[model samples]
Target chain A: MCELLAMSANVPTDIVFSFTGLAERGGVTGPHVDGWGISFYEGKGNRTFKDACPSSESHIAELIKSYPIKSEIVISHIRQANRGCVSLVNTHPFSRELWGRYWTYAHNGQLTGYLDKFKVSRFQPVGYTDSELAFCWILESVVKQFGEQEPDDLNAVFDYIAGLADEIRQLGVFNMLLSNGVDLMAYCTNNLCHITRRAPFGKATLIDTDVVIDFSKETTPNDVVTVIATRPLTNNENWVVLNPGEWKLFRKGELIRS
Target chain B: MCELLAMSANVPTDIVFSFTGLAERGGVTGPHVDGWGISFYEGKGNRTFKDACPSSESHIAELIKSYPIKSEIVISHIRQANRGCVSLVNTHPFSRELWGRYWTYAHNGQLTGYLDKFKVSRFQPVGYTDSELAFCWILESVVKQFGEQEPDDLNAVFDYIAGLADEIRQLGVFNMLLSNGVDLMAYCTNNLCHITRRAPFGKATLIDTDVVIDFSKETTPNDVVTVIATRPLTNNENWVVLNPGEWKLFRKGELIRS
Candidate 1:
């Protein structure tokens, strides 16, 4: 059990507003306070800031709040330890390199016996967590299926990941966010919601705190931003909660319906 | 081409004092302002802070100097780009996971046609830099030689890496620092120095900044700390410079003579 937050945008965008709401849950409003982490993808490179302390009190988290690191794809998580000990290695938003591209992953739900059932190759889990083990299993399967080259058909990759997600969902709750700087994936077994803000964006308010921002003032007409979280972050936005065992793929903030 | 700093200690130790000197070279004292990165190992996990911004003026660098994230093993670099563009991907201190352990590397010198000489397999470089390519090749070679299990004999691995370093040095300058949380390795082709501080510690002043710290007051008598850098960080301490083909291995802050 944890909390997940992710973003995909047509342009380089900062997730300070949504992060403020989700970070509040790390200790202030929710019980997930063991640790937290965030990854921001910029071009071929991405930056990750993780703290073993709760996000509500971590100095690095405070720096992340103050620093507006803009990126096109971002994935974040705040954990409440279920299986692994509280340490830096067990913190979420784990990353690996595949196809010469860095891929980031964060899970909000727990698996029952992933380490016992799953097999890992190429990508191995550095920490003792079922979430990381599942991620490693997924990547290992990807490498086995696709080799070092990314599939030419995006839909084929999407369907492949969808099948993987369905299989993982049978093990336990499998809500997670994954991205490789360009492609964003969301898989939900129990809890997850997403909202996309396009050209005629309006003001939004955080449900956790009394913070509001006018998107019109902050974004251009061409900017398209999509944010997904374990729960709805804003009070007024219409977030779409997926059905159980459902998965979706997005690129540059646009949903891939295929 | 750049400045490098590394530390290995018997106990968790912060490098704020040495980092202050090395960071100054990013823009204030020298011209390695293209990018900078530092990795601090905590148990099996490591935290890396990278910025394309100059370390002399980066807010993240300021946080690093202020917050004392103590660790037993650390590797840092400030880069002046030669083979890649001045971007976040081209930053030094590139890392990859091998045998479920995160291996960090930072190079201070340039290579001539490393892409032609080195053959990378199993591991791939996420960044377009000779340094990253070299790191990938080394890790690939390590995996190829030792398989998934680390060698029981440390000297054999050290000798293997030494041979790899010698081969790369034939291409060009190859001063670099490498670590896998348990062991720290240093190889010098041009500029590098090392100093070990233990009992009977004394005050040391920075050469790049007007800062002084009394190690006796800050450390226990039994503590052993080794600091390695492109140049001596302290003005008063005597540092041993390695020969062009010399390589040293350290474990738990003690030099491994075996």
Candidate 2:
């Protein structure tokens, strides 16, 4: 099993505080110490940092903790390595370019015999992991239905992704975080939760470490930031847990319903 | 114009010493202060770090200089922003995956009306840069000629790339460094050079910065390393300057002719 973390913000917001909590769980407070990675989306461009080393001790991870790289969308993962060998290729938050847009994905649970059922084309997995295979399969599905151009109606694409997620969940646990820079689509097959903070935000305490941050001081009245994770990072926030087979679409910190 | 740097080695070797000199050229020694990026290939997987800030002042660049994240192939660039905005999307060392292997590219010169001359289809440019457009067109050409599978006889592919580079050079200055993890292909239009270091490695001094290193202390007798750049990175080394329209392919630190 692994852990997933993501963010969709109305403004260019940094996830340093949330990532600090998650990085600690990579080895300090949890068992997922194999590897960790994060992606920051800046406009149409994305910067990703990945390593096979434990995030708790990684020097790159330490830079991420202090560097405030702001982004509208972000995806992160910490892996425990069950299906593939612990290497850079097997690390999660896999990314591929589709329709000229970079799509990133991270998974929390293992899928049994996914390679046997999924057909892949156009996109291929560079890594030998179920997560990367699943990502390629999803991109293949998108390419099949949408071709080289994205659909005019993004809601239609969302519904199509939801359909694909439902099919993937049938194989096994398939909690995932996926984004194409503009929108973030998360599907929960087992355990997932999210929290959106806006306007009059208050102080929040981290669950993994004794760190508290006052969002009211850091954010303006117009800022809206939504964070999704396998588990809630803050102890005081009222995170909305998703039911099995449920999926949600987020853009600029707000949920969208098709 | 931007500056390009690359390394191909028989063993996993870090470019911290050379990169330190290049980082100095990013802002301290040269005027290419717009942005910078680098790609490190670990097996089949590649990790990239990009910033729209000057490499000389970037904390990420500092981290890269100190972190010994060794790799057999690397491509790095420091931008002066001729054809695109100074943003993460426009940063050099653009990459896309094809044939289940990640291919990275970096350009050091401008293209004249390349958008009108070249047509992009399967591979599209995510950023508004002539360099990215050229890379996509090159990859598209490769895909059209070889389909989704890499040719078993890689020399055939190399010849095709040399032909394509010759054509692209006709349009404008087309100095480039491209790699698919296993092989590194560098095309020179103007101002490109390379050097290969092997048994009985000697001390070298950087041209852009005050740094000296003895390769004999760091490398084994069996190690073979090749360094390529827009200009010679080290002052004392006998760098082989490539003629205009001349390109070279390197595999395991040795030149593979087209």
Candidate 3:
């Protein structure tokens, strides 16, 4: 339904190369031309750029192409609307503050009957989209569970989330990627793929458009990068396909679970 | 502007502890009620949820609180619209397919005059938002630079991106975080913060909202985690503050770059 791109590297690297090829699908190669957004983590902060205009024609998009905003981790998205109206308030890669840290999230599937299931206390949807409503509901759930103090059990928390996801998936397709500032996570109920780059670099080609890049020339012996997407962006590379009802955790260009 | 939260851990951990406090800002404590999103990497994919509604009032948000969804890497976001129209097409945490992987992206700052500069050959914005246009432009640029091959020189690419970001920064505030699946890169032009968690677990408390969580009980002795945010997520924990024009790279919950 949409496209996703993410990179986790050992060094401060630019996603321009991969991003270039993916941009084609925003409106040209594929149908996810709803909107686009990308964030480059510089240091303690990040440099982000977003636009509702098509990436194929936006001047700002061109600027990002030529720019080398490097980061160890990066996330980018192009949307194909399903639940929310086509507008900025409904754009992917939504953000919020939790425990003082900035959390970023993006989704790529529809949640049937999500509106009825989700409800917030103080938070209310600004736009009429099931995706956003779901986000708020998740936040409220966490607050209710921990009651201010951060939870110490990580596995238990994940289990709880998995249960929720299972429930949501039953309604419809639910695929997504999320990161705060530290690590990245991806889940796929229908279609999702991923690639991890290590010291031994290789070549990759864009599937939507005719674009390619050699990793050997762009990385050192110590660089490790991992990318996650709803579909394989490159036609040549052996992208890892995720099974239905699958999820993965990545840190420093390595897959902890599959 | 929007808020972001991320956590990287050596062992599986739950974010509910921190999420509890963060959810407060979704309209309860802060004003980022436009929408919210979160993704947790469980095994190979991720468990993601979003809501067009406020985190405080969404049923999905409440579900997240009750859910466990423990993950080594997590990304969450709450939005305050600035660019795209308020709708689902404009939601954050956009996902796409690239290089046989799912890529996710989210942004927090605004970019003026982005529409005038971006032009995508294949990728076009489905919705009308500056964030989406930027994402497409970056994707297009990557394709243009390296055709059918991944870049071998990451440093060169980073430099190129940095230059591009500098240009974009001239337009407006550019703060962001990006990750593919391996490592994380954080850049701060304005306000962004981060903290790494390792062997020694500690206690944390939320600043924007009144919440606290102790990590020591839930983590193993060898646990290592890192958190990143627009602002320090915890008031008690010592969060690293990024300098203007500074960037940091992370790998496996450890700081690779200062």
Instruction: Calculate DockQ per candidate and list them.
Output: 0.68, 0.82, 0.02
**Interface DockQ of candidate 2:** 0.82
Candidate 2 colliding pairs: none
Q: Among all windows of ten consecutive residues in candidate 3 chain B, which has the lowest summed lDDT?
A: B94-103
lDDT of 1 by residue, A1-258 (tens): 899999999999999998999899999998889999999998999888999999998999888888899899999999999979999999989998876788899987778856666887567788998888888888888878887767677577667877898899988889978887778999998999999999798999999988999999999999999999999998898999988988888899999752
RMSD of model 3, in Å?
24.2
Q: Give lDDT: candidate 1, residue A123.
A: 77
User: Chain A: TM-score in each candidate?
Assistant: 0.97, 0.98, 0.91
Per-residue C-alpha lDDT of model 2 across residues A16-45, encoded as one tens digit per residue: 999999999889998889999999999999
Estimate every model's Cα lDDT from 0 to 1.
Answer: 0.89, 0.91, 0.67
Instruction: Determine which window of 10 residues in candidate 1 chain A has minimal summed lDDT.
Output: A113-122
Give me the displacement of residue B36 in model 3, in angstroms. 25
lDDT score for residue B196 of model 3: 76
lDDT of 3 by residue, A129-228 (tens): 6765676676567667655444676445445555666677887887867665566667779888888887688888887777778989998998888888
State the displacement of the C-alpha of residue A92, model 2, in Å, after optimal TM-score superposition: 1.7
Q: Please list the Cα RMSD from the true structure of every candidate, rounded to 1 decimal place.
A: 1.3, 0.9, 24.2
The sequence of per-residue lDDT tens digits that candidate 2 reaches over residues B137-229 is: 989998889988667887887789889888889889999999999999889989899999998999999998888999999999999999999
lDDT of 1 at A120: 71
Once fitted onto the true fold, the runs of candidate 2 whose alpha carbons sit more than 4 angstroms away are none
